[model samples]
Target: MIPIRSAGPADVPVILSLVRELAAFEREPDAVTATEAMLADALFATPPAAEALIAERDGEVAGFALFFHNFSTWTGRRGLYLEDLYVTPAARGAGVGTALLRHLAGIAVDRGCARFEWSVLDWNADAIAFYRAMGAVGMEEWTVQRVDGAALTRLAGR
Candidate 1:
C-alpha cells in the first residue's frame, strides 16, 4: 500500500528532484527553475506559502503533491489549489498518485475548504483521463490568465 505523509524541510532535496522529474515528464525538462533552498523557504517558512505530501511505497519515494490555499471570492471561503501532482514513471501503475490526491482531498475536507482544484495541461490526455475518472470536471468555459517577467514588471511600473 502507498503511504502518504507531510513533507518537512529535510525533504527539500527529494522534492526538488521529483519536481524536475515531473517537468521532464510534462515534456518541459528545462521548465523547473526551483532550487532546494527555494522549496524549503516556500514550504517550511514561518508562514509557509505552500504544503507538500510525499507518497511512498514500501519505503521508496513514489510521488508528491504540492499545494497551497486560495481564496474564492464568490464562495467567500478558502480552497485548496494543487500546484503539482506527480508520480514517478516506475511507480505510475502502483496507485501512488491516486493515493496522494485522495490524501489531499481529505485534508481539504477536514480544513473546511470550499473546493479542491488544479489545472492539467491540455495536451496531457492521460492526466485528463485520470482526473475525469476521479469525478473532476474541466472548467471549459474558464480560461487561465497570467502575467509574469517583463510584463509583470511593466504592469507594476517597476
Candidate 2:
C-alpha cells in the first residue's frame, strides 16, 4: 500500500521542493515564488489556509497533494479544491497518484464536501485522460478567471 500521511511542519522543505518540480513540469520553472517560511505559515498557521498529504515510496518522499476548502453556494456546502497534485517521476504509474486522489476523495466525502475539483492545464492531455479515467468530467462551459499581482492591487484601487 502507498503510505500517505498528513504533512507537518517538518515537511515544509520537501513540500516546497515538490512544488518546484511540479512548476518545472508545468513548463513554468521560474513561476514559483513561495519560500519555506511562507509555506509553513500558510499551512501550519492557526486555521490553516490549506492542507497537504504526503505520499511516500520506498521510505522516501514521492509526492504530495495540497488543497483547501471552498464554499459552494449552489450546493450549500463546502467543496474541496485541489491546488496541486504531484508524483515524482520515479513513482509515476506506480499507483501513488491514484492512491493520493482516492485519499482526497475520501476526505471530501468524510467532510461532507459538495464536490472535489481542480484545474489542469489545457496542454496536459495525459493528466486530463487520467482524471477522466478516474470518473471526472470536464466543465467545458466554465472558464476560470483570475487577477493577481499588480493587477489585483490596481483592481482594489490601492
Give the per-residue lDDT digits (tens) of candidate 1, residues 21-131: 988988999988888988999999989999999999879888999999999999999999999998988899889978988899999999999999999999999999999
lDDT of 2 at 40: 100
Please, what are the lDDT tens digits per residue for candidate 2 over residues 1-158?
99999999999999999999999999999999999999999999999999999999999999999999999999999999999999999999999999999999999999999999999999999999999999999999999999999999999999
**Alpha-carbon runs more than 4 Å astray in model 2:** none
User: TM-score for all predictions?
Assistant: 0.97, 0.99
| Per-residue error (Å), model 2, residue 107 | 0.3
After TM-score superposition, what is the CA distance of residue 41 in candidate 1 from its true location, in Å? 0.5
